[model samples]
Target chain A: NAGVTQTPKFRILKIGQSMTLQCAQDMNHNYMYWYRQDPGMGLKLIYYSVGAGITDKGEVPNGYNVSRSTTEDFPLRLELAAPSQTSVYFCASSYSFAGQGSSYEQYFGPGTRLTVT
Target chain B: EDQVTQSPEALRLQEGESSSLNCSYTVSGLRGLFWYRQDPGKGPEFLFTLYSAGEEKEKERLKATLTKKESFLHITAPKPEDSATYLCAVLPYGGATNKLIFGTGTLLAVQP
Candidate 1:
C-alpha cells in the first residue's frame, strides 16, 4: 500500500543550496509528520500537518519548511541548506481514531539521507 | 519539561539471549507511550503502545509492559535480526495532535 514514501533516498548538497524532500502516503491518514534524525540522536519533529491546508511547527522547526497541499502528500523544504541540516529525514502518518489515546503508533517512511557539504 | 529517557544506550547480546530495554519518561499526565524499531537506513517501525500502568502488549518475540513512570520492552530469545535501535515516546496532554517526546533510543546488537 506504500504506507509512506519519501523521495531521494540519498542526496548531497553544497552549502547554501536548497532542496525539497518529498513525502507521500497512500493510507489516507489525517495526520502527517516530518522528523529528522541525527547520529546517536532521537528523531526530532521538524513540522507536521493535521490535514491538507493545515501545518504547524514542531520541536525543531528551524532551518526547514513544510507544505501539505493535499491529503496524500507532505513535503519538507530545506532553504539554503546548512551542515546542520544534514541528517536523515523521515515522514510519518497515523489515524485520528481515538481523538486522544494510544492511536498514535505512527507509521514511518524509509527516510531520506541528506548530506550537506 | 516533557522528556523521555532510554537506559543502557547500547546493548550487545548473543542470539537467543533474553533481555529487556527500558524507557523512562517524565511528563504532565501521560496520554500514551509508544515503542518503535528502526533498522539501518530505514524508518522506525511501529511496535507497541501502552496506555497506562499495568498495560501489556506482545508481538512475536517482544513484550512491552507499562508502569506509571516507565515502560519495558522484553525480548524473548532474540534473534540477530532483532538487532536495531528501539525508540520510546510519550504523548502529553494538551492537544490531540499526538505530539510526542522521544528518547534517544537503545541500540541493541544481537550477535550470532
Candidate 2:
C-alpha cells in the first residue's frame, strides 16, 4: 500500500489567493484528517472526516474547508489565504471503528509546506 | 483543558548512549497515548501506542512506558539514525470523536 500521499510538497501563495491541497490514501482508511504544524506549536487539527460525505471542524478550521468524497481522498481548500496560514500541512489517515483494537494508529503523508505572502 | 507537554526541547547524546524523553499530559481521561518520530523535512512516523497506564511496549532500540500522568520513550542504545524529533499525542476518552492532542515534541541529536 502506498499509504497516504499529498500533492505539492511546497507552495507560496499571494495574499487572497486560493489553492487546494490534495490528499489520498491507498490503505482504505475510513478516517482522514488535516493538521497544521507550526514551529513550537505542535500539530493542530484543521478538519476531519469519518467517511465519505462526512466532515467536521477541528481545533483550527478558520480560512480552511474540506471535502471527503471518497474513502481514499480528502482535500483541504484554503480560500483567501493569509500569512497566518503559513505552516506545514499534514494529511493523515487511519482505519478505525468502534471495537476495533488495531485501527487507532494514524499514518501520515510527507506534508505540504505552504507560505502566504 | 486537555494538553500534552514534552520536556527537554532538545538533547544531544553521544552514539551508544542511552536516554529517555518525557511526555507529560493533562486530560480528563485517556484512551491512548502515541509516540511518533519525525525526521526533518518528513512526516511523522508512528512508533508505539499505549492504551493504559502501567503499559509498556518496546521496539528494536526504543521502549515506551506509560504511567497515569506521563509517558517515557527510552532509547536503549542510540545510533545517529535514531536522531529525530519525537512527538507525543493523547487520544482522550469521550464521544465517537478520535481527535488527538499533541505535544510540541523533544528533539534528539545523537552525535558520533
lDDT leader: 2
Count steric clashes of candidate 1: 0
lDDT of 2 by residue, B1-112 (tens): 9989999899999999999999999999998999999999999999999998899999999999999999999998899999999999999988776888999999999999
lDDT of 1 by residue, A1-117 (tens): 979999999999999999999999998898999999998789899999998999999989998999999999999999999999989999999877553443777899999999999
For B1-112, candidate 1 gives per-residue lDDT tens digits of 9989998899999999999999999998987899999888899999988888999999999999999899999999999999999999988878868788889999999999
Candidate 2 deviant stretches above 4 angstroms: none
Considering only chain B, report the TM-score of each candidate against the true chain B: 0.97, 0.98
Interface RMSD of 1: 0.8
Lowest lDDT block of 10, candidate 1 chain B: B93-102
Candidate 2: RMSD to truth? 0.8
Worst ten in a row by lDDT for model 2 chain B: B92-101
Candidate 2 share of real interface contacts = 0.81
State the DockQ of every prediction: 0.89, 0.89
Which pairs of residues have clashing backbones in candidate 1?
none
